[model samples]
Target chain A: MKVIKITAVWCSACLIMNKRWKEIEKDYDVETISYDLDFDEDEVKEYEVGEKLPVFIFLDGDKEIGRLIGEKSLEEIKKYIEELN
Target chain B: MKKLLKYILVFLFFFCFLVNVNAKEKVTLYFFHGDGCPHCAAETTELIKDLEKRDDIKVVKYEVWHNQENSAFLDKVMAVYKTKTGIPYNVIGDTAIVGYNEANKFEIERALEYYKEHNDKYRDVVKLIKEGKEVKINDHYSKQDDKTDKDTTITIPFIGEFNVKNISVGSAAVLIGLVDGFNPCAMWVLLFLITALIGLKNRKRMILLGSIFLLTSGLVYFLIMFSWLNIIISVSTSILFRTLIGLFAIGAGIYNLYAYIKNRNQDDGCDVVDEKKRKTIISRIKKFTREKSLIIAILGIMALAISVNIVELLCSAGLPLVFSELLAINNITGMKAVVYDLIYVIFFMLDDFIVFFIAVKTMDVIGFSTKINKYSHLIGGIIMLLLGILLIFAPGIIMFNF
Candidate 1:
């Protein structure tokens, strides 16, 4: 499973969530790809997020599984991932 | 040997004389200020700025409300010197100077000169402490000397590693929360909740359900606002941000003032209502409970409450942002951020609960009619206006020069 976490330098919520995601990834078969939204315009467009940074797009074998936006709890993200599986 | 002893005695006499002439008087200047008083705030700022420039004098500031002795003294001073209002008053030696005018400055200078004249008396007192000698402080010196031997000698317990940024940010968040909770705008929500509860047939259930609903609504409001705090702080310095906040506050204030005026006009004209009409209104409200589900009704009430003060909420959202930004720069960790947010939300809800209960009790005592329950809207509006004004002017008014 490929979990691409797109965020900016100044996005504090993203940084905090990223820290939690790192801990969670240690237990799951998750490949996390982080990108700076300010610089990576092509990556942001690829995710279909119009100017919205700090969005998590979960992909399972080239198919888009789910996407979560805004500041979400680790539990909420975990639940979303579990439902996808 | 006798000649050598005489020479040493002369040298000792000359050394003592030089020490007396060169001794610096340790003058402790104390300033007291209030939270809301503009003049007091200005005086304190000026005094602080002035003290920073002077190495010879030291200023000890005590917020009147926070300090028991200062508060008591302030009360006494208020009673004794009726003309002396606001802060930055200087109590030098025996005299007091109120305001930051030239006259006050001259008076303060005179007092300082008098203190210098009698500097020899206090010199021994200060010297004893400096020399590590046990000095008994009498009442005369104690009144002027804000610092005692114990104060200078005792070491305060260090709670954590000293971090300036953390402390500043933490304090700013707390201050913002306090200001938000205290805002008159929040008062109206409490008023409406109380009136609505009292109007309900099942008073106990209504109170409980209403409190829960209001608390939940408050939580939702807090979370939404807290989440947006970082965004606000990130872009706070922008002109667009300032204008949005300013306009929102002013607009809310105007709306509230209009509502209050309209309500006042209605109250003056209406004295009697037909019994049938009153009964119909009561029946309609009663139907709300019988026909609608409790969960739906709670949601409906929450929606109604939130809708009425949407502007106020928007304005308050700015506070958390300002606070969070201030905190974030101080390296406030994720855990501390959660704790600070929780504290703010809890305090905010508690304040609402208190105001709600008070308004309910007041209405009950006065025996306000069910038909006039809508008057709570007017109260809420007035609170909004006051809060808007406070938000708009508080910082500037507080820092105004005397």
Candidate 2:
């Protein structure tokens, strides 16, 4: 599974997610791609990211499957991943 | 032999010169004035101007309007002199000159001259105060040296002249009130009451009920204090009774300290009310409030208030008892006693007001109330312990004079 994390340097909520994302990736063996909302606007636009930074776009191959917005706990993210079928 | 005698005479001459130089007699006059008082400001300026030329006279001006501590000190000075009046008050040696006038200024200068000649009179007072004894001017310093042999009692303001020990009544009231205000039992009862009221969803009713509860609590507390006051006035001269009260304070303080240490981690205990008793009261309140009639509900609320007051007094009675005991020793009576009781109740209700106001407005958004409730024991315990020890050992600390 490919997970794209949309974030910004100034976003506090995004910084929080960045911390949990590191631990989640190490434990779950998942591939995570981080895109900056400001500098990497092209990738963000390509993925149809909204004004909200700190969102996670889950994808299988090139097609977007689901997304988690705002702040989510490790369990919440895990639950969303399982439901992505 | 002649040369040695000449050297000895010269040495003696220099020694006497040094002694005379040191004996210039430096007097520090305390001038307590209020802020924005035209008379005080003018008087202070004049006093300073007059004293500026004399290096031997040092002026210490305490602004009493904005400073409660300074104001309290002023009150202490007044009480000692047996003068009840306003400020621009000056204290020099044994002389306390109230209000700055031409005559008073002359009187102050004359007094200063007298003290310079007989500096030994007030020097002991200055030394005692420097050593942190709760020495007051009218009581300790102003008296004639010849009368010292006869004077046995020491007068401290607010607490008055007690045979056993000296403590201030006002500061004691504040400290005990603050500690009592944070009683876990009282806080629990308040929280319970608020939660029940919130369920009813009527803000008006909640306000009415809360006001009644608080007023009734105050009334019950005042009644207890009134009776205590009567008892105290009758036996105000009893030194043994005063000592017994002091012992009681020490014991109460120890219990609080022990309770805090024992239940440092518990959710529902702070020695103010036991867990079992608290649960029982809460259950009873729920059942009592479930009734539908307005008059019956009002009566139920009053009953709850009375019961909660009793429980709070049980758990947190140490400070109030200490307050009453202090009052008893001070010989407070008539309207003065009544006034002090009112002031004490105001301070006692301060915490309840803050907690309930916040609870009603924000509904405990930060869960701060819970956290305070958890640590109330530790905070209350420490205060009580210090107060208790002071009551037993050095009661001067109770007045905050040092």
Candidate 3:
């Protein structure tokens, strides 16, 4: 599974989830592509990130299955990835 | 030659004589106002009357919003006075009064009294700056904030006239408080707790435990908002800070709107807490039920309430921040401010109270429909959007002109 993460520097949730996502990467066999809401505007906008922060979009070879928005614990992140698989 | 010398000496004496302005000399009040601002317009009318009647204080008016010079001068005087932003601002001596109301009028009268009595110490700092002279600020007068005109005054648009009164902010407190009560996080905990409480055979323990939880939640709400109020009041909030909060509001509003749209198919859930935290809360609830010691159970409930509300606070950060910022901008403080926060806390707890009461009487948990919470996000989104825009462009309206 591929994860497209949309985050912003200013969002507290995004900052929080950033650490959790890194930990998730250590356990899960997922390619996580991160894009900043501001600096990487064009790419982030394509995802239609309609507010909230630290968006994690799960993809099955670019066909999006689901997305999670906002801060989540490491276990929750792992649970989502496992469910997706 | 002697007559000529005597004439020159007399002229010199006359010039130096009145230079030392007597105690009765009128105190100059430099008022920086906005032309279309409700508070400024309302204050202007009252100050004009004071100008007409009072011989000891002279009101100098500068229309800042429409005039470049006045606006720039406002910056200069603000630098000297160290007054925080939000207007209908008055610079009286070294003291800066940020808003106008009846409470402020009393403070102004008192300030004028002080300056008049201590005329030798009085300096027209604004005038000195206007004259391109160096000004040294030596005294700090009352740091007290005062109110504007009447208790309920209305103003005609573009007319710059108002008799004024105060009601709108209190109304805002009630309205915002009521709406803000429909928070997902706060509701979620109470829902979870009620199911636990309803299973209890002893109504007294149920009542005691439930009341403790709700009271703790309400206290946390009050303390948090009150602390924000104090921080905003104490910190000299610059335009930059206001702009940042404005941006945050807009961001939060957009997020709320997004939540409203996205949650159409999803269930009402707490996104802020993890499964581990949820389990911990559940375990704690179980302990509260199993504990034979009443004191231990009460303490546990209190701890649970405090912890739950802290997370709830995270989920519902937008309203309290906005509410406190609103209070600061409107210059609503002291006992009036305490009362406002109380109104907010009571209203915030209204839903939780109703839910708890219903659960006790009927021995069943009652929850608000998800639709209500959904629609609230939509409405809340719109209000926050408006407040955010006003906070940036026209803050005086946020001061509640109507």
For this target, which candidate reaches the highest TM-score against the unseen true structure?
3
- Regions of model 1 farther than 4 Å from truth: A1-85, B1-167, B232-292, B315-317, B358-402
Clashes by residue pair, model 1: B40-B87
Candidate 1 CAPRI category: incorrect
lDDT for each residue of candidate 1 in B27-137, tens digit (9 for 90 to 100): 655555545546556555655577657876666565653455555555454333222233555554334454454445445555556666776544333223335555343
Which prediction has the highest lDDT against the true structure? 3
Off by over 4 Å in 3: A1-85, B1-27, B32-37, B41-86, B94-118, B124-164, B265-273
The full ranking of all candidates by DockQ, starting with the best, is: 3, 2, 1
Please list, in the order the candidates appear, how each scores on TM-score for chain B only: 0.37, 0.51, 0.75
True contacts kept of each: 0.00, 0.00, 0.00
Docking class of 2: incorrect
Worst 10 residues of 2 chain B by lDDT: B364-373
Runs of candidate 2 with Cα error greater than 4 angstroms are A1-85, B1-168, B263-280, B287-290, B362-402
Model 1 residue B220 CA deviation in Å: 3.1
What 10-residue stretch in candidate 1 chain B is worst by lDDT? B141-150
Model 3 lDDT tens row, A1-85: 8989886533434545777788888887889899976568689878987645568899999799989876555777778777878
Task: Write down the RMSD of all candidates, one decimal each.
Answer: 23.7, 20.1, 13.7
Q: How should the candidates be ordered by lDDT, best one leading?
A: 3, 2, 1
Better of 1 and 2 by DockQ: 2
